[model samples]
Target: MKGMTIIVKTVSSWIKVLVFLFGIYIILFGHLTPGGGFSGGVILAGSYVLLLLAFGREYAEENLPLPIASKLDCIAAFLFIALALLGFIYGAGFFFYNFLQQELMADCNAAGKLVSAGAIPLYNIFIGLKVAASLFLVVLVLSAFRSESDPTEGQE
Candidate 1:
């Protein structure tokens, strides 16, 4: 299956970019708002899923090939772990010890500013990356089951 109709492809083309950007916004400003890494990550994955649905498996894979997705998955996992390890070396000898200082304002209120969030935003970004890549890969691989089980579903 290549895709649905031109309407779906066009609408999804616009929606996917917006969804991806909104996911980034959520990850970046998570500490300032209610949303966080998990939510943003789901949204990000949804954008790719939208692509997969609108353009089919092959098109989505072409857009984000397996090698690239795998590399991203590894990089994100390593970076997230390395970030946590920093707490042991630089923090109070504990894991995730909030080593980074929160940026305070002149009035002594740093509640919702982007810089005021300390390592939370960085953590959110890493989590978002990892979650997105992980989910994308899972969906991609699970989709394989559909074809393998039927054998003639995608073949004409």
Candidate 2:
């Protein structure tokens, strides 16, 4: 019902930050590489899951409560939609067209650079946030139900 041993806690304390950072990196560089929003989202979700496992459900909930997770999930999705819709204004009515395609930057269109991708990084970030929150919320709710339904909460 609670967290794991001290070793797990210590290792995870360091690992979670690396994983979270990697998740963001994946999302940011998704367009050029293989990973994308979905993969990065799953990775981000994994970071929260790591926190839950290492710090217990109570701590996880304190760090990312259900209400805040739900609100962030919805907001991220809405922001993604709004951003996509903005392409219509600059993309000639296209759904997800690159509005910032040819603004004459220094070298954004280079083959293998972080800023080469237009709107893709933003999309990945939003989707990653949405998915991370949704996954955390689901896991937390399920764990709550599981804890409540357990037959040995206070029997010991």
Candidate 3:
């Protein structure tokens, strides 16, 4: 009653999972593929946006509350900064250096492994989280606003 019909809700529920998975895939394999943190984060936020559209703001808020999203955004930012600064502590002597790559270089051939990119993947993960949370918050806030008469009522 508060949102679209049951058919839309059910379909959105199913599709959201796939979208979320695709976003994770993009974030994880971004170093190898074209899509990365920013694109994947947008895709991730879009999954929640689809839910909000199909199930209403209240339902979406219940699943991912504003406070939790806010905290996630902040935590992700801190982690990204920490990852960058870790290079300094590890004698990389530069911000955003590939410190992990250096250590792994002596271990084995990292030609096609997941850990090959090292800090890049970590950065992507944190960046993906931050972007997803930020975009979702924006859409959620925008969705909260509504005119009294309803925008669709007086239209043809």
* Backbone clash count, each prediction separately: 0, 0, 0
TM-score of predicted structure 2: 0.92
Q: For model 3, how does the per-residue alpha-carbon lDDT over 1-156 read when each residue is reduced to its tens digit?
A: 168998998999999999999999999988888999999999999999998889888888998999999999999999999999988877458887878777655585466676567688899999999999999999987777652346773563
Off by over 4 Å in 1: 102-109
Whichever of 1 and 2 has more TM-score, that candidate is 2
Q: How many backbone clashes does candidate 1 have?
A: 0
From the highest lDDT down, the ranking of the candidates is 3, 2, 1
Candidate 2 lDDT by residue in tens digits, 1-156: 679999999999999999999998888888889898888988998999999988899998888888999999999999999989988887789888767754435356786878876777788889989988898888888888988898998795
Whole-model Cα lDDT of every candidate shown, in order: 0.83, 0.86, 0.88
Error of 2 at 78 (Å): 0.5
- Candidate 3 off by > 4 Å: 147-156
All candidates: TM-score: 0.88, 0.92, 0.89
For residue 2, give model 3's deviation from the true position in Å.
1.5
Tell me the tens digit of each residue's lDDT in model 1 across 1-156.
577899999999999999999999988889888798989988998899899888999988998898898888889889888888888877767787666762223353478677765677888898898888888888888876776797778677
Q: Candidate 1 local accuracy as lDDT?
A: 0.83
Q: Which whole-number lDDT from 0 to 100 does residue 12 have in model 1?
A: 96
